[model samples]
Target: MKAKARAHANIALIKYWGKSDENLSLPMNSSLSLTLDAFYTETEVEFTNSINEDVFFLNGVEDKNTLSKISKFLDLFRIARNMNERAIIKTINYVPTAAGLASSASGFAALAAATNKASGLDVNSRELSTFARRGSGSATRSIYGGIVEWQKGINDKTSFAVEIDDASWDIGMVVVIVNREEKKMSSREGMKSTILTSPFYKNWPEDSQKDLKEIKIAIKEKDFEKMGYITERNALKMHATMLGANPPIMYFEPKSILVMQIVHELRDKGIPCFFTMDAGPNVKILCRLSQGEMIKNRLMEDFKEYEIIVTGPGPGVEII
Candidate 1:
Protein backbone atom coordinates (compact mmCIF):
# COMPACT_ATOMS: atom_id res chain seq x y z
CA MET A 1 0.00 0.00 0.00
CA LYS A 2 1.21 3.48 -0.83
CA ALA A 3 0.00 6.87 0.23
CA LYS A 4 1.21 10.45 -0.06
CA ALA A 5 0.20 13.48 2.04
CA ARG A 6 1.09 17.06 2.90
CA ALA A 7 0.85 19.04 6.15
CA HIS A 8 1.85 22.59 7.05
CA ALA A 9 3.89 23.86 10.00
CA ASN A 10 2.20 25.91 12.74
CA ILE A 11 3.41 28.70 15.05
CA ALA A 12 2.05 28.68 18.57
CA LEU A 13 0.19 31.83 19.56
CA ILE A 14 -0.38 30.59 23.09
CA LYS A 15 2.56 28.24 23.53
CA TYR A 16 2.52 24.69 24.81
CA TRP A 17 5.56 25.02 27.06
CA GLY A 18 5.60 21.89 29.23
CA LYS A 19 4.22 18.37 28.99
CA SER A 20 2.48 16.44 31.72
CA ASP A 21 3.08 13.09 30.07
CA GLU A 22 6.20 13.26 27.98
CA ASN A 23 5.95 9.68 26.77
CA LEU A 24 2.50 10.30 25.30
CA SER A 25 3.32 13.83 24.21
CA LEU A 26 0.56 15.35 26.35
CA PRO A 27 1.00 19.00 27.14
CA MET A 28 0.44 20.74 30.48
CA ASN A 29 -1.31 23.71 28.87
CA SER A 30 -3.68 23.80 25.97
CA SER A 31 -2.15 25.62 23.00
CA LEU A 32 -3.31 27.58 19.99
CA SER A 33 -1.51 28.06 16.63
CA LEU A 34 -1.75 29.49 13.19
CA THR A 35 -0.78 27.10 10.41
CA LEU A 36 1.24 29.04 7.86
CA ASP A 37 1.35 28.43 4.13
CA ALA A 38 5.07 29.15 3.70
CA PHE A 39 6.30 26.10 5.61
CA TYR A 40 5.14 22.53 5.10
CA THR A 41 6.22 18.93 4.61
CA GLU A 42 5.20 16.33 2.05
CA THR A 43 5.54 12.63 2.82
CA GLU A 44 5.03 9.40 0.95
CA VAL A 45 4.59 6.08 2.70
CA GLU A 46 4.78 2.58 1.22
CA PHE A 47 4.02 -0.46 3.31
CA THR A 48 5.62 -3.50 1.78
CA ASN A 49 5.64 -7.21 2.66
CA SER A 50 9.26 -7.68 1.63
CA ILE A 51 10.89 -5.28 4.08
CA ASN A 52 11.80 -6.37 7.63
CA GLU A 53 11.96 -2.88 9.22
CA ASP A 54 10.81 0.68 8.77
CA VAL A 55 13.05 3.09 6.80
CA PHE A 56 13.01 6.87 6.57
CA PHE A 57 14.46 9.31 4.06
CA LEU A 58 14.51 13.10 4.46
CA ASN A 59 15.14 15.30 1.44
CA GLY A 60 16.43 12.27 -0.51
CA VAL A 61 18.95 11.24 2.16
CA GLU A 62 18.54 8.30 4.55
CA ASP A 63 18.47 9.27 8.25
CA LYS A 64 18.87 6.54 10.86
CA ASN A 65 18.18 8.69 13.92
CA THR A 66 14.99 10.02 12.37
CA LEU A 67 14.04 6.52 11.28
CA SER A 68 14.15 5.25 14.86
CA LYS A 69 11.63 7.91 15.91
CA ILE A 70 9.40 7.28 12.88
CA SER A 71 9.48 3.53 13.45
CA LYS A 72 8.13 3.98 16.93
CA PHE A 73 5.54 6.43 15.62
CA LEU A 74 4.48 3.92 13.00
CA ASP A 75 3.95 1.35 15.71
CA LEU A 76 0.80 3.18 16.88
CA PHE A 77 -0.77 2.69 13.48
CA ARG A 78 0.66 -0.80 13.15
CA ILE A 79 -0.69 -1.92 16.46
CA ALA A 80 -4.13 -0.50 15.66
CA ARG A 81 -4.27 -2.08 12.21
CA ASN A 82 -2.57 -5.33 13.25
CA MET A 83 -0.12 -5.01 10.42
CA ASN A 84 3.42 -6.40 10.39
CA GLU A 85 4.55 -4.74 7.14
CA ARG A 86 7.47 -2.34 7.20
CA ALA A 87 7.27 1.08 5.58
CA ILE A 88 9.54 3.20 3.41
CA ILE A 89 8.82 6.85 4.18
CA LYS A 90 10.28 9.81 2.32
CA THR A 91 9.67 13.39 3.50
CA ILE A 92 10.36 16.64 1.70
CA ASN A 93 10.36 19.76 3.86
CA TYR A 94 9.77 23.22 2.45
CA VAL A 95 10.68 24.74 5.83
CA PRO A 96 14.18 24.92 7.27
CA THR A 97 14.84 22.09 9.73
CA ALA A 98 15.50 22.53 13.45
CA ALA A 99 15.27 26.34 13.28
CA GLY A 100 12.30 26.74 15.60
CA LEU A 101 10.02 26.57 12.58
CA ALA A 102 7.77 23.74 13.77
CA SER A 103 9.13 21.36 11.14
CA SER A 104 8.45 18.33 13.33
CA ALA A 105 4.80 19.38 13.67
CA SER A 106 4.32 19.24 9.90
CA GLY A 107 6.61 16.23 9.51
CA PHE A 108 4.74 14.05 11.97
CA ALA A 109 1.34 15.26 10.81
CA ALA A 110 2.27 14.28 7.25
CA LEU A 111 3.66 10.95 8.45
CA ALA A 112 0.52 10.24 10.43
CA ALA A 113 -1.64 11.07 7.44
CA ALA A 114 0.42 8.98 4.97
CA THR A 115 0.87 6.03 7.30
CA ASN A 116 -2.80 5.94 8.25
CA LYS A 117 -3.76 5.95 4.60
CA ALA A 118 -1.25 3.25 3.74
CA SER A 119 -2.59 1.10 6.56
CA GLY A 120 -6.21 1.55 5.42
CA LEU A 121 -7.32 3.59 8.43
CA ASP A 122 -10.09 6.01 7.52
CA VAL A 123 -10.41 8.01 10.68
CA ASN A 124 -11.99 11.40 11.35
CA SER A 125 -9.96 14.58 11.85
CA ARG A 126 -10.13 14.35 15.64
CA GLU A 127 -8.92 10.76 15.55
CA LEU A 128 -6.28 11.83 13.05
CA SER A 129 -5.24 14.63 15.42
CA THR A 130 -4.99 12.18 18.28
CA PHE A 131 -2.86 9.89 16.14
CA ALA A 132 -0.65 12.79 15.06
CA ARG A 133 -0.28 14.01 18.66
CA ARG A 134 1.34 10.72 19.61
CA GLY A 135 4.11 11.60 17.16
CA SER A 136 4.58 15.30 18.01
CA GLY A 137 2.43 17.29 20.43
CA SER A 138 2.20 20.23 18.04
CA ALA A 139 1.17 17.86 15.28
CA THR A 140 -2.30 17.85 16.80
CA ARG A 141 -2.73 21.50 15.83
CA SER A 142 -1.12 20.88 12.43
CA ILE A 143 -3.97 18.53 11.60
CA TYR A 144 -6.28 21.52 11.27
CA GLY A 145 -6.12 24.59 9.08
CA GLY A 146 -5.96 28.29 9.96
CA ILE A 147 -6.21 29.06 13.67
CA VAL A 148 -6.52 25.91 15.78
CA GLU A 149 -6.76 25.30 19.50
CA TRP A 150 -5.25 22.12 20.91
CA GLN A 151 -7.12 21.12 24.05
CA LYS A 152 -4.75 19.48 26.50
CA GLY A 153 -6.85 16.47 27.32
CA ILE A 154 -6.12 14.31 30.34
CA ASN A 155 -5.48 11.30 28.11
CA ASP A 156 -4.96 10.17 24.53
CA LYS A 157 -8.64 9.85 23.62
CA THR A 158 -9.60 13.39 24.56
CA SER A 159 -6.50 15.28 23.46
CA PHE A 160 -7.13 16.77 20.01
CA ALA A 161 -7.27 20.07 18.16
CA VAL A 162 -10.20 21.99 16.71
CA GLU A 163 -10.36 24.90 14.34
CA ILE A 164 -11.14 28.13 16.13
CA ASP A 165 -11.15 30.50 13.20
CA ASP A 166 -10.85 30.28 9.43
CA ALA A 167 -8.35 33.18 9.55
CA SER A 168 -9.65 34.55 6.25
CA TRP A 169 -9.34 38.03 7.70
CA ASP A 170 -6.54 40.43 6.87
CA ILE A 171 -3.88 38.69 8.97
CA GLY A 172 -0.57 37.03 8.18
CA MET A 173 2.81 36.03 9.59
CA VAL A 174 6.31 37.13 8.49
CA VAL A 175 8.95 34.55 9.43
CA VAL A 176 12.54 35.73 9.92
CA ILE A 177 14.90 32.77 9.62
CA VAL A 178 18.14 33.87 11.32
CA ASN A 179 19.78 30.46 11.72
CA ARG A 180 19.37 27.18 9.84
CA GLU A 181 21.56 24.96 12.00
CA GLU A 182 20.02 22.81 14.77
CA LYS A 183 19.76 24.37 18.22
CA LYS A 184 22.00 23.23 21.10
CA MET A 185 19.07 22.30 23.36
CA SER A 186 16.12 20.40 21.90
CA SER A 187 12.56 21.57 22.66
CA ARG A 188 11.98 18.49 24.77
CA GLU A 189 15.17 18.91 26.80
CA GLY A 190 14.66 22.63 27.21
CA MET A 191 11.06 22.12 28.30
CA LYS A 192 11.92 19.39 30.82
CA SER A 193 14.83 21.36 32.25
CA THR A 194 12.66 24.42 32.72
CA ILE A 195 9.80 22.46 34.25
CA LEU A 196 12.02 20.80 36.82
CA THR A 197 14.19 23.73 37.83
CA SER A 198 12.40 26.99 37.02
CA PRO A 199 10.13 28.19 39.82
CA PHE A 200 8.44 30.47 37.30
CA TYR A 201 7.36 27.35 35.46
CA LYS A 202 4.59 26.89 38.01
CA ASN A 203 2.60 29.86 36.71
CA TRP A 204 3.20 29.30 33.00
CA PRO A 205 0.22 27.05 32.40
CA GLU A 206 -2.16 29.39 34.23
CA ASP A 207 -0.89 32.44 32.35
CA SER A 208 -1.02 30.60 29.05
CA GLN A 209 -4.61 29.56 29.76
CA LYS A 210 -5.62 33.16 30.36
CA ASP A 211 -3.92 34.20 27.16
CA LEU A 212 -5.70 31.41 25.35
CA LYS A 213 -9.08 32.65 26.55
CA GLU A 214 -8.39 36.30 25.75
CA ILE A 215 -6.90 35.50 22.36
CA LYS A 216 -9.98 33.48 21.45
CA ILE A 217 -12.18 36.44 22.24
CA ALA A 218 -9.91 38.70 20.22
CA ILE A 219 -10.10 36.34 17.28
CA LYS A 220 -13.91 36.29 17.47
CA GLU A 221 -13.98 40.08 17.45
CA LYS A 222 -11.49 40.04 14.53
CA ASP A 223 -9.34 42.52 16.42
CA PHE A 224 -5.82 42.14 15.04
CA GLU A 225 -4.29 44.67 17.44
CA LYS A 226 -5.69 42.95 20.51
CA MET A 227 -4.63 39.51 19.29
CA GLY A 228 -1.13 40.70 18.42
CA TYR A 229 -0.70 42.38 21.81
CA ILE A 230 -1.70 39.29 23.77
CA THR A 231 0.36 36.93 21.58
CA GLU A 232 3.54 38.98 22.02
CA ARG A 233 3.16 39.16 25.79
CA ASN A 234 2.35 35.45 26.03
CA ALA A 235 5.46 34.50 24.03
CA LEU A 236 7.65 36.72 26.20
CA LYS A 237 6.25 35.08 29.32
CA MET A 238 7.11 31.64 27.91
CA HIS A 239 10.76 32.64 27.43
CA ALA A 240 10.85 34.10 30.93
CA THR A 241 10.42 30.64 32.41
CA MET A 242 13.57 29.42 30.63
CA LEU A 243 15.59 32.27 32.10
CA GLY A 244 14.46 31.42 35.63
CA ALA A 245 15.72 27.85 35.35
CA ASN A 246 18.62 26.83 37.64
CA PRO A 247 21.00 26.64 34.69
CA PRO A 248 19.29 29.34 32.61
CA ILE A 249 18.35 28.46 29.04
CA MET A 250 18.05 31.32 26.60
CA TYR A 251 16.82 31.19 22.99
CA PHE A 252 17.23 34.81 21.84
CA GLU A 253 20.45 35.85 20.11
CA PRO A 254 21.61 39.40 19.36
CA LYS A 255 19.76 39.42 16.05
CA SER A 256 16.58 38.23 17.73
CA ILE A 257 16.70 41.17 20.11
CA LEU A 258 17.28 43.54 17.23
CA VAL A 259 14.30 42.13 15.37
CA MET A 260 12.11 42.50 18.45
CA GLN A 261 13.12 46.15 18.71
CA ILE A 262 12.36 46.66 15.03
CA VAL A 263 8.88 45.25 15.60
CA HIS A 264 8.41 47.65 18.49
CA GLU A 265 9.62 50.52 16.30
CA LEU A 266 7.13 49.47 13.62
CA ARG A 267 4.36 49.48 16.21
CA ASP A 268 5.40 52.93 17.41
CA LYS A 269 5.12 54.11 13.82
CA GLY A 270 1.51 52.75 13.80
CA ILE A 271 2.26 49.66 11.69
CA PRO A 272 0.62 47.42 14.33
CA CYS A 273 2.87 44.33 14.38
CA PHE A 274 3.85 41.89 17.12
CA PHE A 275 6.71 39.39 17.41
CA THR A 276 6.81 35.84 18.79
CA MET A 277 9.67 33.35 19.08
CA ASP A 278 9.69 29.65 19.78
CA ALA A 279 12.63 27.65 21.13
CA GLY A 280 15.01 29.29 18.62
CA PRO A 281 16.66 32.54 17.63
CA ASN A 282 14.32 33.20 14.68
CA VAL A 283 11.49 35.73 15.07
CA LYS A 284 7.99 35.68 13.58
CA ILE A 285 5.96 38.85 13.26
CA LEU A 286 2.19 38.96 13.08
CA CYS A 287 0.71 41.85 11.13
CA ARG A 288 -2.10 42.79 8.82
CA LEU A 289 -1.88 41.25 5.34
CA SER A 290 -1.88 44.71 3.75
CA GLN A 291 1.19 45.72 5.81
CA GLY A 292 3.19 42.54 5.04
CA GLU A 293 5.43 43.99 2.32
CA MET A 294 6.06 47.15 4.30
CA ILE A 295 7.21 45.07 7.27
CA LYS A 296 9.30 42.86 5.01
CA ASN A 297 10.94 45.86 3.37
CA ARG A 298 11.73 47.42 6.75
CA LEU A 299 13.25 44.15 7.99
CA MET A 300 15.39 43.88 4.82
CA GLU A 301 17.12 47.19 5.55
CA ASP A 302 18.95 46.02 8.68
CA PHE A 303 19.02 42.20 8.46
CA LYS A 304 20.39 41.63 4.98
CA GLU A 305 21.79 38.21 5.86
CA TYR A 306 18.57 36.65 7.13
CA GLU A 307 15.74 35.07 5.12
CA ILE A 308 12.29 36.59 5.57
CA ILE A 309 9.18 34.76 4.38
CA VAL A 310 5.67 36.22 4.42
CA THR A 311 2.74 33.80 4.57
CA GLY A 312 -0.92 33.56 5.51
CA PRO A 313 -2.97 30.79 7.09
CA GLY A 314 -2.76 27.34 5.45
CA PRO A 315 -5.12 24.38 5.14
CA GLY A 316 -5.20 21.12 7.04
CA VAL A 317 -3.42 17.90 6.09
CA GLU A 318 -4.57 16.30 2.87
CA ILE A 319 -3.91 13.12 0.91
CA ILE A 320 -2.55 13.71 -2.55
Candidate 2:
Protein backbone atom coordinates (compact mmCIF):
# COMPACT_ATOMS: atom_id res chain seq x y z
CA MET A 1 0.00 0.00 0.00
CA LYS A 2 1.23 3.49 -0.79
CA ALA A 3 -0.06 6.93 0.19
CA LYS A 4 1.13 10.51 -0.10
CA ALA A 5 0.21 13.41 2.20
CA ARG A 6 0.97 17.08 2.77
CA ALA A 7 1.10 19.06 6.01
CA HIS A 8 1.93 22.71 6.42
CA ALA A 9 4.32 24.24 8.95
CA ASN A 10 2.93 26.08 11.99
CA ILE A 11 4.15 28.95 14.15
CA ALA A 12 3.19 28.64 17.77
CA LEU A 13 1.33 31.63 19.15
CA ILE A 14 1.55 30.11 22.61
CA LYS A 15 4.82 28.19 22.57
CA TYR A 16 5.30 24.56 23.63
CA TRP A 17 8.52 24.95 25.56
CA GLY A 18 9.13 21.95 27.87
CA LYS A 19 8.13 18.34 28.01
CA SER A 20 6.61 16.29 30.84
CA ASP A 21 7.53 12.96 29.30
CA GLU A 22 10.37 12.79 26.84
CA ASN A 23 9.75 9.32 25.49
CA LEU A 24 6.11 10.03 24.68
CA SER A 25 6.78 13.58 23.52
CA LEU A 26 4.23 14.95 25.99
CA PRO A 27 4.36 18.66 26.54
CA MET A 28 4.70 20.40 29.90
CA ASN A 29 2.15 23.01 28.79
CA SER A 30 -0.51 23.30 26.14
CA SER A 31 0.32 25.40 23.08
CA LEU A 32 -1.63 27.23 20.37
CA SER A 33 -0.44 27.74 16.80
CA LEU A 34 -1.44 28.98 13.38
CA THR A 35 -0.48 26.82 10.41
CA LEU A 36 1.17 28.85 7.64
CA ASP A 37 0.67 28.25 3.96
CA ALA A 38 4.16 29.31 2.97
CA PHE A 39 6.11 26.22 4.08
CA TYR A 40 5.14 22.58 4.26
CA THR A 41 6.31 19.00 3.86
CA GLU A 42 5.00 16.31 1.58
CA THR A 43 5.72 12.66 2.30
CA GLU A 44 4.96 9.34 0.63
CA VAL A 45 5.02 5.98 2.39
CA GLU A 46 4.78 2.48 0.99
CA PHE A 47 4.60 -0.77 2.94
CA THR A 48 6.27 -3.72 1.31
CA ASN A 49 7.40 -7.16 2.36
CA SER A 50 10.25 -6.98 -0.13
CA ILE A 51 12.19 -4.53 2.03
CA ASN A 52 13.97 -6.03 5.05
CA GLU A 53 14.20 -2.68 6.81
CA ASP A 54 12.83 0.80 6.50
CA VAL A 55 14.50 3.12 4.01
CA PHE A 56 14.10 6.91 4.00
CA PHE A 57 14.81 9.52 1.37
CA LEU A 58 14.51 13.29 1.86
CA ASN A 59 14.50 15.75 -0.99
CA GLY A 60 15.75 13.16 -3.50
CA VAL A 61 18.71 12.21 -1.29
CA GLU A 62 19.05 9.24 1.05
CA ASP A 63 19.14 10.54 4.61
CA LYS A 64 21.15 8.27 6.89
CA ASN A 65 21.18 10.62 9.91
CA THR A 66 17.38 10.62 10.27
CA LEU A 67 16.83 7.01 9.17
CA SER A 68 16.85 5.54 12.69
CA LYS A 69 14.38 8.11 13.94
CA ILE A 70 12.00 7.49 11.05
CA SER A 71 12.28 3.73 11.53
CA LYS A 72 11.50 4.06 15.21
CA PHE A 73 8.42 6.14 14.44
CA LEU A 74 7.34 3.62 11.82
CA ASP A 75 7.72 0.88 14.39
CA LEU A 76 4.86 2.44 16.35
CA PHE A 77 2.53 1.86 13.40
CA ARG A 78 3.85 -1.64 12.82
CA ILE A 79 3.38 -2.59 16.47
CA ALA A 80 -0.10 -1.14 16.70
CA ARG A 81 -1.30 -2.75 13.46
CA ASN A 82 0.42 -6.12 14.04
CA MET A 83 2.45 -5.73 10.89
CA ASN A 84 6.04 -6.95 10.46
CA GLU A 85 6.98 -5.61 7.07
CA ARG A 86 9.20 -2.56 6.90
CA ALA A 87 8.29 0.47 4.80
CA ILE A 88 9.90 2.94 2.42
CA ILE A 89 9.40 6.60 3.33
CA LYS A 90 10.17 9.57 1.12
CA THR A 91 9.67 13.17 2.32
CA ILE A 92 10.46 16.61 1.00
CA ASN A 93 10.57 19.66 3.30
CA TYR A 94 9.86 23.11 1.96
CA VAL A 95 10.78 24.75 5.25
CA PRO A 96 14.26 25.06 6.68
CA THR A 97 15.03 22.03 8.84
CA ALA A 98 15.78 22.59 12.54
CA ALA A 99 15.95 26.37 12.19
CA GLY A 100 12.93 27.03 14.42
CA LEU A 101 10.56 27.11 11.48
CA ALA A 102 8.69 24.03 12.68
CA SER A 103 9.93 21.84 9.82
CA SER A 104 9.67 18.72 12.01
CA ALA A 105 6.07 19.64 12.77
CA SER A 106 5.01 19.46 9.13
CA GLY A 107 7.46 16.68 8.28
CA PHE A 108 6.21 14.28 10.93
CA ALA A 109 2.58 15.24 10.41
CA ALA A 110 2.84 14.44 6.72
CA LEU A 111 4.63 11.19 7.50
CA ALA A 112 1.97 10.20 10.02
CA ALA A 113 -0.87 10.88 7.58
CA ALA A 114 0.84 8.99 4.78
CA THR A 115 1.76 6.10 7.06
CA ASN A 116 -1.78 5.86 8.40
CA LYS A 117 -3.27 5.59 4.92
CA ALA A 118 -0.51 3.36 3.57
CA SER A 119 -0.77 0.95 6.50
CA GLY A 120 -4.57 0.97 6.61
CA LEU A 121 -4.59 2.23 10.20
CA ASP A 122 -7.61 4.38 9.33
CA VAL A 123 -7.28 6.46 12.46
CA ASN A 124 -9.08 9.81 12.76
CA SER A 125 -7.41 13.24 12.85
CA ARG A 126 -7.12 13.27 16.66
CA GLU A 127 -5.50 9.85 16.67
CA LEU A 128 -3.24 10.90 13.82
CA SER A 129 -2.13 13.88 15.94
CA THR A 130 -0.97 11.61 18.76
CA PHE A 131 0.95 9.47 16.31
CA ALA A 132 2.62 12.58 14.94
CA ARG A 133 3.44 13.73 18.48
CA ARG A 134 5.59 10.67 19.04
CA GLY A 135 7.86 12.08 16.33
CA SER A 136 7.80 15.72 17.52
CA GLY A 137 5.71 17.55 20.12
CA SER A 138 4.83 20.41 17.77
CA ALA A 139 3.75 17.92 15.15
CA THR A 140 0.74 17.21 17.32
CA ARG A 141 -0.66 20.63 16.46
CA SER A 142 0.42 20.59 12.81
CA ILE A 143 -2.19 17.90 12.09
CA TYR A 144 -4.79 20.66 11.90
CA GLY A 145 -4.89 24.07 10.31
CA GLY A 146 -5.82 27.59 11.48
CA ILE A 147 -5.67 28.18 15.24
CA VAL A 148 -4.90 24.80 16.84
CA GLU A 149 -4.06 23.89 20.42
CA TRP A 150 -2.31 20.81 21.74
CA GLN A 151 -3.71 19.94 25.13
CA LYS A 152 -0.94 18.92 27.56
CA GLY A 153 -2.94 15.94 28.72
CA ILE A 154 -1.89 13.47 31.40
CA ASN A 155 -1.02 10.75 28.85
CA ASP A 156 -0.75 9.95 25.19
CA LYS A 157 -4.46 9.27 24.80
CA THR A 158 -5.38 12.57 26.39
CA SER A 159 -2.89 14.79 24.55
CA PHE A 160 -4.06 15.80 21.09
CA ALA A 161 -4.87 18.93 19.13
CA VAL A 162 -8.18 20.73 18.69
CA GLU A 163 -8.92 23.45 16.22
CA ILE A 164 -9.72 26.71 17.99
CA ASP A 165 -10.64 28.67 14.90
CA ASP A 166 -10.70 28.27 11.13
CA ALA A 167 -8.73 31.52 10.73
CA SER A 168 -10.92 32.75 7.91
CA TRP A 169 -10.39 36.36 8.86
CA ASP A 170 -7.56 38.82 8.26
CA ILE A 171 -4.83 37.00 10.17
CA GLY A 172 -1.52 36.09 8.55
CA MET A 173 2.27 36.09 9.11
CA VAL A 174 5.41 37.45 7.47
CA VAL A 175 8.42 35.18 7.97
CA VAL A 176 11.89 36.72 8.07
CA ILE A 177 14.62 34.24 7.29
CA VAL A 178 17.48 35.40 9.46
CA ASN A 179 19.48 32.18 9.39
CA ARG A 180 18.42 29.12 7.42
CA GLU A 181 21.24 26.86 8.67
CA GLU A 182 20.44 23.96 10.92
CA LYS A 183 20.56 25.09 14.53
CA LYS A 184 23.42 23.90 16.74
CA MET A 185 21.01 22.99 19.54
CA SER A 186 17.76 21.29 18.68
CA SER A 187 14.36 22.10 20.21
CA ARG A 188 14.45 18.82 22.17
CA GLU A 189 17.92 19.54 23.56
CA GLY A 190 17.14 23.15 24.38
CA MET A 191 13.87 22.35 26.14
CA LYS A 192 15.49 19.56 28.17
CA SER A 193 18.26 21.84 29.37
CA THR A 194 15.83 24.61 30.23
CA ILE A 195 13.51 22.29 32.13
CA LEU A 196 16.36 20.90 34.23
CA THR A 197 18.27 24.14 34.81
CA SER A 198 16.07 27.21 34.51
CA PRO A 199 14.59 28.37 37.77
CA PHE A 200 12.08 30.56 35.93
CA TYR A 201 10.78 27.55 34.07
CA LYS A 202 8.86 26.41 37.14
CA ASN A 203 6.10 28.94 36.46
CA TRP A 204 6.22 28.72 32.69
CA PRO A 205 3.48 26.12 32.39
CA GLU A 206 1.05 28.08 34.53
CA ASP A 207 1.85 31.31 32.73
CA SER A 208 1.47 29.69 29.35
CA GLN A 209 -1.82 28.14 30.36
CA LYS A 210 -3.18 31.54 31.29
CA ASP A 211 -2.01 32.93 27.96
CA LEU A 212 -3.64 30.05 26.13
CA LYS A 213 -6.94 30.71 27.83
CA GLU A 214 -6.90 34.42 27.04
CA ILE A 215 -5.71 33.92 23.47
CA LYS A 216 -8.49 31.45 22.82
CA ILE A 217 -11.02 33.99 23.99
CA ALA A 218 -9.41 36.70 21.89
CA ILE A 219 -9.50 34.48 18.83
CA LYS A 220 -13.14 33.58 19.41
CA GLU A 221 -14.04 37.23 19.76
CA LYS A 222 -11.86 38.20 16.79
CA ASP A 223 -9.87 40.72 18.80
CA PHE A 224 -6.68 41.11 16.83
CA GLU A 225 -5.06 43.57 19.25
CA LYS A 226 -5.55 41.33 22.27
CA MET A 227 -4.40 38.26 20.37
CA GLY A 228 -1.28 39.97 19.07
CA TYR A 229 -0.31 41.21 22.53
CA ILE A 230 -0.68 37.81 24.13
CA THR A 231 1.13 36.05 21.28
CA GLU A 232 4.15 38.36 21.53
CA ARG A 233 4.24 38.23 25.33
CA ASN A 234 3.98 34.45 25.46
CA ALA A 235 6.86 34.04 23.02
CA LEU A 236 9.04 36.43 25.01
CA LYS A 237 8.39 34.45 28.18
CA MET A 238 9.34 31.21 26.44
CA HIS A 239 12.69 32.66 25.35
CA ALA A 240 13.26 34.08 28.82
CA THR A 241 13.11 30.60 30.28
CA MET A 242 15.77 29.47 27.83
CA LEU A 243 17.98 32.39 28.76
CA GLY A 244 17.61 31.48 32.40
CA ALA A 245 19.08 28.02 31.80
CA ASN A 246 22.29 27.24 33.68
CA PRO A 247 24.50 27.62 30.62
CA PRO A 248 22.16 30.31 29.23
CA ILE A 249 20.85 29.24 25.83
CA MET A 250 20.19 32.23 23.62
CA TYR A 251 18.58 31.80 20.19
CA PHE A 252 18.53 35.45 19.23
CA GLU A 253 21.19 36.56 16.74
CA PRO A 254 21.99 40.20 15.98
CA LYS A 255 19.68 40.24 12.98
CA SER A 256 16.98 38.60 15.02
CA ILE A 257 17.07 41.48 17.46
CA LEU A 258 17.04 43.95 14.59
CA VAL A 259 13.90 42.38 13.18
CA MET A 260 12.15 42.54 16.54
CA GLN A 261 13.07 46.18 16.90
CA ILE A 262 11.62 46.92 13.48
CA VAL A 263 8.38 45.21 14.42
CA HIS A 264 8.16 47.30 17.57
CA GLU A 265 8.77 50.47 15.57
CA LEU A 266 6.06 49.49 13.12
CA ARG A 267 3.63 48.93 15.95
CA ASP A 268 4.40 52.36 17.34
CA LYS A 269 3.53 53.78 13.92
CA GLY A 270 -0.03 52.38 14.29
CA ILE A 271 0.77 49.23 12.35
CA PRO A 272 -0.78 46.34 14.21
CA CYS A 273 1.96 43.76 13.93
CA PHE A 274 3.74 41.61 16.47
CA PHE A 275 6.77 39.32 16.28
CA THR A 276 7.34 35.83 17.66
CA MET A 277 10.30 33.49 17.48
CA ASP A 278 10.92 29.83 18.13
CA ALA A 279 14.24 28.18 18.98
CA GLY A 280 16.05 29.89 16.10
CA PRO A 281 17.38 33.18 14.78
CA ASN A 282 14.45 33.85 12.47
CA VAL A 283 11.49 36.09 13.34
CA LYS A 284 7.87 35.82 12.24
CA ILE A 285 5.56 38.83 12.21
CA LEU A 286 1.88 38.29 12.94
CA CYS A 287 -0.36 40.79 11.18
CA ARG A 288 -3.62 41.25 9.34
CA LEU A 289 -3.63 39.75 5.86
CA SER A 290 -4.42 43.16 4.41
CA GLN A 291 -1.32 44.62 6.07
CA GLY A 292 1.06 41.76 5.26
CA GLU A 293 2.36 43.45 2.15
CA MET A 294 3.00 46.70 3.98
CA ILE A 295 4.79 44.90 6.80
CA LYS A 296 6.92 43.00 4.30
CA ASN A 297 7.82 46.17 2.47
CA ARG A 298 8.88 47.94 5.65
CA LEU A 299 10.99 44.99 6.75
CA MET A 300 12.49 44.70 3.30
CA GLU A 301 13.86 48.23 3.60
CA ASP A 302 15.82 47.18 6.69
CA PHE A 303 16.49 43.57 5.76
CA LYS A 304 17.54 43.98 2.18
CA GLU A 305 19.69 40.83 2.16
CA TYR A 306 17.16 38.52 3.90
CA GLU A 307 14.27 36.58 2.40
CA ILE A 308 10.80 37.50 3.60
CA ILE A 309 7.64 35.53 2.87
CA VAL A 310 4.07 36.55 3.54
CA THR A 311 1.81 33.66 4.44
CA GLY A 312 -1.77 33.05 5.53
CA PRO A 313 -3.54 30.24 7.35
CA GLY A 314 -2.99 26.85 5.71
CA PRO A 315 -5.07 23.68 5.65
CA GLY A 316 -4.80 20.59 7.80
CA VAL A 317 -2.80 17.49 6.91
CA GLU A 318 -4.39 15.78 3.93
CA ILE A 319 -3.71 12.75 1.77
CA ILE A 320 -2.69 13.90 -1.67
In lDDT terms, which candidate is top? 2
lDDT tens per residue, model 1, 228-247: 99999999999999999989
**What number of backbone clashes does candidate 1 have, counting pairs of residues 3 or more apart or in separate chains?**
0
Please identify model 2 stretches exceeding 4 Å from their true place.
96-98
lDDT of 1 at 161: 96
Candidate 1's displacement at residue 231, Å, is: 0.4
Q: Positional deviation of 43 in candidate 1, in angstroms? A: 0.3
Local distance difference test, each candidate: 0.93, 0.94
> Residue 304 of candidate 2: its Cα lDDT?
92
- TM per candidate: 0.98, 0.98
Give residue 89's error in model 1 in angstroms: 0.6
Model 1 / residue 242 / CA error / Å: 0.7
For candidate 1, the per-residue lDDT at 180 reads: 84
Clashing pairs in 1: none
